[model samples]
Target chain A: MKNLTIPEEELMLPGHTACLGCGATLAMRYALKALGKNTIVTIPACCWAVIPGVYPARTLEVPLLYTAFEVTGAAISGIKNALEATGNDDINVLGFAGDGGTADIGIQSLSGAVERGENVFYIMYDNEAYMNTGVQRSSSTPKGAWTTTTQVGKVRDWKKEKKKNMVEIMVAHNIPYAATASIAFPEDLIKKLEKGKNIKGPKFYHIYATCPTGWRISPSKTVEIARLAVESKVFPLYEVDHGVYNITYMPKKNVSVKEYMLPQGRFRHLTEDEIKEIQSEVDKDWNLLLEKEKWTQSLNKVQ
Target chain B: MKKMLTGNYASAYGAKVSKVKVVSAYPITPQTTIVEKIAEFIANGEFDGKYIRVESEHSAMASCIAAENTGVRTFTATSSHGLALMHEMLHWASGARLPIVMSVVNRSLGPPWSIWSDQQDTISQRDTGWMQIYTENNQEVLDSIIMAYRIAENEIVMLPAMVIEDAFILSHTMEPVDIPDQADVDEFLPDYNPKFKLDVSEPMGFGSLIMPEGPFMEFKYKGHESMNNALKIIDETDILFKKKFGRSYGGTVETYKLDNAKYALVMMGSTASTGKEVVDKMRDEGYEVGLLRIRSFRPFPKDKLRNYLSNMKSIGVFDRSYTFGYGGAVFSEVRNTMYGKNIPIKGYIGGLGGRDVTMNLIEKIFLDVVNMSEKGQDKDYEWVGLNGDKRWSQ
Candidate 1:
């Protein structure tokens, strides 16, 4: 028998209301499988809020707590602390929020929880835009993405700002474990979550979730696009463990940014010159991450 | 044991005795000391609970809701701006049917920035499905918290509660409070064991989305029914607490000298203390005046209020918070309660923004109600104790 890397248990059932090929739904499935049934997930107002069927019917097998849009961090902290108070400290408290809820409105509460060193997992599923609210521009929306609020029209006013680095934000709080994962790699995503489940204190994961409807791509292309994001270095797969950085995976072949951006309609309007600029920016960021890993490892060796 | 404790410390000690398992709070003026004292108790190993020093009041209330959802007693405290910030979660707590208790140190809201006593902070949250109890002194502040948990955690009344203390007047003022014994409190107010909770062994979803055809309205109606059901529970808890500790702040509404009185003065919170003294003075002078203090505001005690004010020729409802377009918040509700009683209920707006509700002001209100009972109807309401040239006497 082959060694199974991913768990077989179906914690997130099939009757969800997620859009076809929704990467966020798959991310949740992998997360629940990794954390097992002894988990309580507190979801803020996001795609998952509706994905789990309305009252009387639910998709996740684990206990779920739905909180207000900006209060996921606080809710998880409360649950974890209360569980500890009751002498039942083995259960996992998970906070799952979308990009808009995390990178913008919920940042203060999330930062507070991380700084307080609450024992929980805060996973932010990034779909680039506010997919649940119909592709409105969020802080996590990448540069030059054509969201509803950031239209690529007569004046070429796409998203002018760069994507917010959520993992970096968690790392800035000096969290015990902070990592970036993609829906395409379930084994890697599940591994990080299972590892974080053992370590005490706050662990944050920034998962790349593709939205076919919001990005104007085919429903079947969700995992493919997510793979492209990681392979082309638009979103790197790396973990920062207590100031020590380790890149989890490196692409076997050098994939260009043009290959990643060409598929989705959100970035189809990017001119040749704009594509070149994005390529250079991605290369620069990847190199900075490399230097950080090398320098931190050298410092660790000396100590 | 009797201890000289501020209302804030009284609140902390109340939670300590109640054996609250989780306390999440933020630091706001007049409310900071309550959590600070709780922190001290936790540091000294006096209180066995988990304290989350949250970043903001919104998070504080949110954490309280989550903790209570896990089927444990939870508490929090905040003043004006912090209470306002926690407005959304206040509704969330009650809507989720989590019996979370909080101490709201009532202070005036800003735009003018005052940190003094007023009912506006808690008054604004009247419709948020929370059982609000106004306390007169440090003793009531402590006792109400212990009572609030019992009443709120009742099987029929699964609602959150606010034990409101006037900022500076009660929150900062020191008074001798008899702290109940831990064994006595444990017997009186039992541990919170929720019927349904967020548990790993019993997996269920809470606060999920309900479609329009679903039970959203039904859930809200259940909350309303639970609030009305809490009136009986509040009285029962008060009686039980009195049996255990030999102290009780007359359930819902406390009355003084209302028997065979021609006119009545209505009030809430600390101002009622002044009203009590004024009632005594008027009684000695052979004036037919009495004082009716509303202890529970959310479950308005409508029937009890109407029963007390039925025989009075006229009634004066004093409010520290106004409704802007109309009279006071309590005045409107009192009038609604006595809709066709033919009693001339006049509104007296006073003590706003920490302006003192002095004995003279209470005397003025009683005199006005008495004078109005004899003379014909005049203005429906007037702002008492204003600092302008012309006084309310005119």
Candidate 2:
């Protein structure tokens, strides 16, 4: 018998309204397995706001609070402080927000919470764009991607800007722990959450959650596409501990960025030249992460 | 015990005596001292609660809403633009039925930047479903906080409340206030033990998405019912607070020598103090005038306004905040309450942006109402002390 790495208890019930093979749903399921039942989750205006089945029929086994679209950080801070005030500091306060809720409209509140060193876990589930509002372009949307707002017409109106670096933004706040994980790697994702539980201050996780409907990919290919994202170095799996970076998973086999972009229909209109441009950007980012890991490790040794 | 406390300190003492478990707030002028005094209390070990120093007023209200959801009482204070920033979460707090109480120091909203006393800040938030109490002096500012929590936390009327004090008239002015003992306040307003909270043992989702076919409108209808329930509960709580502390605020509407007057003045906030003084001087001169002060602006004492103003020959409503396209916010509501009545009700817009509503202005308003009644003339409203000639003389 093989040793099971994931917990068996399912805090997210089976009857949620998530679409078939929604990567954000699986990301939540694995996060709950790591956080356990003693956690209170605060969700803002994101897909999970509606995914947590309608009133009188909730999906999460742990207590959940739905707040306004941009107040997830403040809400979680309130929940944690209130719990401490009541002499019950053992309960974990978790803020689960979508990328649009984190990197765009919610950035100020998230930055404030991290700067205050709030004792909470903030998870930014990156579906790349506003999937709940029908695939509008968000600041987290990658370049050369087609969205409702960033249309691919004759003039090529796809998103032209790079995706916002949320993990680096969290790191700049000097948070205790900040990591990037994906739905494809449940073990690495769960390990980061469990490690964050033992830390005393704010811990942030930027999870690459794929959107099958928005990306125009087959529903069953959600996790596979997410795995290709990491393998192509488009979304690396790494964690920063006290300003020191460590890449948790490196691709054993070289995978081109074209392999990750070819399957998703959002990038179908991109020309070879545009894909090459994105590929070079991804390589540059991956090399920078490697240098950060090496340079910060040396700094730690000198200390 | 007696203490010369500013309205801001009174707000802090109110929260302290109520044993509020959480204090989350940001600083804005006039309202800054309230949170500063609370921070001072926390620093001196006098207040045994957690003060979450939020970065902005939107976060302040957001934090208070979530803190209250954890089944603990929470307090926050803001003024002017800070309150404007919190407008969205004010609705969120009441919609979730969190029963959070906030101190709103009423100040003028700015385009030209004025941080003075006016009802515009709290008046603009009248429809946010927060029960707003416009306090006249420092004592009522403190007392209303205790009563507001009791009314808002009632089982049938779960809502948020705002204890409003005029920017500098009350917020910065010091007056003797009776600070209640903690033991007595604990008896008057017990611990907030909500039936449903974010508890791990008994997990449940709050404010989840409801489809059109679900009870979405029903939830809003329930909010209306709860607000209606709050009216009666507010009166009951005021009476109970009086029994415990030996003072009462005359329930939604407070009247002064209004029984036998042919013409009367209707107003709110600190301007009503000047109105009372004007009423006394006019009565001595045999003008048959009195005063009516509106304390609670939401659950707006409609029946009480009708009951008090129906017999008067004419009425004057003094509003510090204008309703743009209309005469005055309170005047519109008061006129609507007196529908089909033949009384010549006139609105007087005055004392805006912290300009003083002096005894002369109040007397002038009274005489104008009296002259309009004598001639059976009706005008919608007039702006007092405009200084139009000096500002725009060609």
Candidate 3:
């Protein structure tokens, strides 16, 4: 992409406790670069909550307020208002949470924060399952994935429900900004985070962070798996700003969903029929997303 | 200006005079009108603040903690289930030492839901490290909200406070409440300007894991000491409030004719208002009975209670909410405080689940305590107004 430009400043300390090739860790690293030192981050219960280590030994250079599992959005709104009240309006407030904390247990508070039009940035690092809880099934777990709760035994159930569409769910609130990003594409992720920070009202970002420990993939292959997810259109790279849909990156040719799933042990047991079904579902989503962007652009043109 | 207001409106006016910077709350029974009145105040330009309409009680408390940490005064209100839902975060707010003030309209917990008055909702939150203040009437509700901020925000006592009132009983019942001047409240509370906040210029992280053996134990040690410190601050604030507004709730525990009485009945919240009425009625009939109303419950008023009970030969505790398999909460605290004093005490658990606690019921409890031949030292509690209780049944 013509010499990708990332800022030189490193906001994450080198001795953090995150696993090797951990996508959420990298996501936090890149996020701090975009947000810089003038940021206050509130983390709900997630991998990052523990990754920062104990009180006096935090890795983040910025101020962080660790909150209860479901209060990230509410905490962000509070921090933002607090800043305004105390005459520190220039600093940014960001809420960082895991998939279980965001798409599942935290959805109501998140929805309330956005509906109230609070000025804050919410980043949901989607690891698909409740990884920190030892890989239990969360609403963000993709279909045909094997989590502890979604065991592939007896009835052969492996998360039959589809992964919750958190981006669309957030957009339904008509917030100023909602975007889908991935750790594989740091430039796009960073750009979107910067854009979100610039927006005055509530902004949400759903970043596809790969979990090697939870998904039973090689730790080194975490970013590769994240890349495959975007290439296969299973986790698209897109942004919706002020009701305007825009797909920022489009792959030249879609690799099948099998190419995305085969390396991960969580999806290893899927049969050819199941792979085809997943492929069809991915194709359906891609087509709908394109149609939405086109219709939104045309509507803008007419108006 | 004196206006007739429910306990809910009194709470709102109290927050208004204090100039709370942020208010976040969710609507539940008995608490809905509190937030409604606050919203009305904010809409009419009476209170200039950021009002967040949170989804649930959990979010409500979460937002208040956040706002409070930012070094601004914050307020919220909730009822039975809402307070229960906020239980986990309530620890965080107090643990982080945020001076957030909340009003709990005390409704009974459910099986078959009832919105009427009971003390369980706030009593359930007693152990959450928050300074708990139970108000007896609309005026106390209004005054306590302001004094709660003054007491809680005192540098030595930077813990959260809850000004609790009974659902429907005080929350819905109307009375004449004196609305104080904003300038006087400003002199009492000042602006909530803390020394630290969530600022990038001076970065600080809260809710960090501190090992108990290390500073974590010290953190709790300080928290407990701060709760103890709040007792003096509460008293001083009460004194100053009297000088400014010409009304003072006898701090910690307000007493009614307890100096000469041989028997006393102890209670808190709106039930104490009923006890006051009954104590007056009993005294009219040449009975030397008294009423000891507990105002600040978390610090437990150990010294004040001992002083009040020192002369009394017997005392009865009227608990509107039971402690389940144990005696009443106030009764348990009383026994714990008077462990060696050997004051004959009887605890009557009644008015649970919003059952009416009439004046006759309270009189019966006092009479029973005065007539008893046994010395205090009972593990069992007397359930008042039970189906076949002869003392209260007739």
Candidate 4:
């Protein structure tokens, strides 16, 4: 166990409007600690858009720009340019979007900014589905997740597609920094973000945010469920720097995907066969990542 | 310190002189060279800025938008398909009111795709709240960018500006352009000082959602008024630019021998250069023909357009892009400008899909306008350079 001391200065204060034990709220709290006060955040149409509260009474301590669901990348980029034009280069320009906003609707602009290597940090809090619009299936929704759009019944239909690998897509642009972090692992999440601050060019952090309300789970189990996701290898914590891959946190005892899926009501309808299939898929992805890490290591040695 | 360059180089020079702190861009034809030159400048240490090699046109716009919001003088360039991909963000940049300057090399849209000279792509984005300025030549391309920053960063008009030039014709074609000295440009256009910006010390909300009919309308109305107010600033700044750089193109509207001329041709972008040549040749042939070059599109120059065309006996509008089913895009706008007026206006839809609008085509347009006015007849929106077999079979 690592000794992690949390920062004292809280940029995101309590008593603001957010669901109890909201993973995104906690994500914001930790993200703000790494970003500090010298940051301006642009948020698009997502749960965070509403969670920030209405004008005259907002929660976020940083300057926030709420843009349309599809234009967060463009808006944040504009803000970043405006900041630089005025000779203020120290402030961090952060874009906070949800899975739906980042992986689906905003993907074009996101890819554009990343390819351009815009000096900005984008944090996408993935709750798997479009939770703000009533748990519709987003591209980030993993296979076999039960959402309103991908319901389970006599039809036996669940999300059939795998979650879009946004980190890889970002890395394909040859972005300087990209990492996957989770709300359950605050220490790891904070460390990755702190490390990201030093890297130039576009930095993307994909945070696995748990949604108790949408997931139909107890609020108390949110963090536990998030941790189980990492431990089960469903959502591995990893970082990619200039195409070099490294797994940030390797789980000690590899837990079955069933153990992680069984606790969540979202995946409750999955049969044993389906669970096994998911486990195999996770193993395949893990092996692929391991190969990439090894290949990067060899390249570094040659260099 | 001084070099004769093309309009594209002038724009790059202007960005360099502005000491642009960041540049994020993607490659598209015509516009590709501008970014390529900048990349070279950055690599060679000719320009001091962080040049981001973005993945797509969307990201290029996003990166510049983000950089601009951070109070940096950021620059980017794109054209045609790239601009279409950036359509969604075009509105975002304007609505957010970030004064990010972008150079759009006007190229014909794809699918029967051709990368040639035309004003269709930029003209299509007229309603995106961006202050659009069309250039007749390379000099205007360079000067318009420097002027764009002034108009965009103005307290009233805190919207992004697009400096548009015809692809290949102006973007690729080389013409002598006086590259302004950095010190002269600095004295002419001071450092950008944003009225409102993203700052951590004084946290403020930006681009926040507004109820459809409430503050949204207020903000939109303000944007409209700002664009309207920009017309005067455009002229004022052009005057200042000339005083500083010793060059000017009569601001938003440039008239080529229009005084006492009974017939006139109106257009924008690089095609205006061809129109000017035609007008001169017609004058040499002892015909009373003139040319009106529309420099500003967003602040559409309605009054100036009306004032110039209202007195002319016959006015011909040459459009490079069609509005599909309707007449030419610019022709429609030109007609709309003269809706309640007594002037005889004829619309000629021509040079689409990057077709060349040569001096001979301009002469044909002028003749058509003259015949239409004399015969009191309106030809049902015709396409130039189409023979009987090539004309629509329908």
Each prediction's TM-score against the native?
0.99, 0.98, 0.96, 0.88
DockQ winner: 1
Q: Each candidate: what lDDT?
A: 0.92, 0.91, 0.89, 0.82
Candidate 2 lDDT by residue in tens digits, A1-303: 998899999999889898887999988999999999999999999999989888888889999999999899899989999999989999999999999999998988888889999999999999999999999999999998999999988898999999999989988999999999999999999999999999999999999999999999999899899999999999999999999999999897799999999999999998899899999999999999999999999999999
Q: How do the residues A1-303 of candidate 1 rate in per-residue lDDT, one tens digit apiece? A: 989999999999989999999999999999998999989999999999999998889999988999998998899999999999989999999999999999999998999999999999999999988888899999999998999999988999999789999988898899999999999999999999999987899999999999999999999999999999999999999999888999999886688999999999999899999999999999999999999999998998998
Error of 3 at B177 (Å): 2.1
Worst 10 residues of 1 chain B by lDDT: B385-394
Per-residue accuracy of model 1 over B72-125 as CA lDDT, tens digit each: 999999989999999999999999999899999999998798998899999999
The DockQ of each candidate is: 0.90, 0.88, 0.74, 0.47
Per-prediction share of native contacts kept: 0.86, 0.86, 0.73, 0.61
Error of 2 at A76 (Å): 0.2
lDDT of 4: 0.82
Error of 4 at A146 (Å): 1.5
Q: Which parts of model 1 have CA positions greater than 4 angstroms off?
A: none
As a whole number from 0 to 100, the lDDT of residue B160 in candidate 2 is: 93
lDDT of 4 by residue, B77-124 (tens): 999999998887788788878888999988888777788867778888
* Model 4 interface CAPRI class: acceptable
The collision pairs in model 1 are none
A94-152 in candidate 4: lDDT tens per residue?
Answer: 88999999999989778766765668899999999999889999999999999999999
For candidate 2, lDDT tens digit of each residue in B1-394?
9999999999999999889999999999989899999999999999989999888999999999999998899999999899999999999998999899999999999988998988889899988989988888899999999999999999998999999899889899999999998889889998999999999999988999888986988888898899888878888888888888999987688899899998989999988887888888888899899899999888788888889899999998889998788799988888889988888998988788988788887888888889888887657887787777332111
lDDT of 1 at B293: 92
